[model samples]
Target: MTIVLAAAAAALFGCGTFLLLQRQLTRVLVGLALLSHGANLVIILAAGGRGAPTFVGGDEDRALLDPLPQAFVLTAIVITFGVTSFLLALAYRSWLLTGDDEVQDDVEDRLIVTRWSVSEELIDAEEAALAAHAEDVARREMDEEAHR
Candidate 1:
């Protein structure tokens, strides 16, 4: 049973990692789901296979299944569900924003670079205009002073 659990864990981990490395956002979300399931399984296995439910008034000597792991798994499932929902929403928003499905950090990076270049150009243009205006004003002041 331990060997089987270990194999299962390894398989889940490998698949999850593979999916996460994919460029598609959906694949990454799926990978996270797989990883969560793998973690839940690991926790349960660590507590031993589901044997019997825990009871307050039951026989104390009987090997009761660990309720802690079950509780933990339930909590984890809820948390994972919330995260999955959020990821889906984010994916949809990204699609709306970019009209592309595959995850693309590179596109965003390029856009940032382009925007920065435009901003720099605007700043340079404004500075040059301000300097030119200042020079004109200084020349007029000098002419007025000479006449006085």
Candidate 2:
């Protein structure tokens, strides 16, 4: 049973993440919803081992299901619902504004990527300089502490 639930959760999260990486807004919304479903399943699986309901009054020795996970799942469901609705509203607005449902890559991001060319040697030099600066600061701090 645990294995089955784990597999299902994994499938949901995998599908959700795959969908999320697409360029369409609708797919992203659906992906978020799927992710929420995966989270709910995880919460259920973590809620506790199968046992008697927590409401039972007199089964002192019997294991009872914990209620915290249930509460958390419920709250998460409400939050996810709100987020989905907001995303739908945004999609609707975007359609009104641009008549397109697909999201385009940001112009700034593309431009920056095209313009920047950092060599491996440059990165190594920057790291070495930063490390030396950090070491100098540490040494000065230690000297100050010794004097005090």
Candidate 3:
């Protein structure tokens, strides 16, 4: 059959790209289920093989087979089995909250190493102490409008 379904979709995309470059998390959830069964064996070898068997009324000369790639590999295996059960429940809630499953480290590298140096130096010392208390309340309201 198309060279044994193109060598079983190149050995399921080379063992799902070597278990998605393993670091664990159950070999990246078995390399996303072997790259979703090598993209449903390349959408059933682009839908075509084992032909012969389809007839609509008065056997209008048989030879059918194209049930739209078996209904698009049964709706892409029920949406990749609900996205592999939501990526194994977010890798079991990231191994129960960070006991380790790897991943983190890039929310803009933890917002540039733990929030730009202590919240930008306490927001520039509270905007230079509110601009020196607004220039001492505008020089005491221009010395009470030059003494009345």
- Please list the C-alpha lDDT of all candidates, in the order they appear: 0.80, 0.83, 0.75
* Candidate 2, number of clashes: 0
Candidate RMSDs in Å, in order, are 13.6, 13.5, 16.5
Best by lDDT: 2
* Model 1, TM vs. native: 0.64
- For residues 1-148, write the lDDT of model 3, one tens digit per residue: 8888889888988898888888767787788788888788888777656555644532556556566876888898899889888877888899897787876555334445655567787656656665676887899899999988
Relative to the true structure, candidate 3 reaches a TM of 0.40
What lDDT, from 0 to 1, does candidate 2 have?
0.83
Model 2 misplaced stretches (Cα beyond 4 Å): 57-61, 114-148
Clashing residue pairs in candidate 3 are none
Please list the residue runs of candidate 1 whose C-alpha ends up more than 4 Å from where it truly belongs after superposition. 50-61, 106-148
Query: Could you give candidate 2's per-residue lDDT for residues 1-148 as a string of tens digits?
Result: 8778889999999999999998789999999899999999999898766655776752757667888888999999999999899999998988887798789666445444544686666656666766786898899999999999
Can you rank all candidates by TM-score, best first? 2, 1, 3
Q: State the lDDT at 67 in candidate 1.
A: 73
Q: What is the lDDT ranking, best to worst? A: 2, 1, 3
For model 2 the TM-score comes to 0.70
Name the lDDT of candidate 3: 0.75
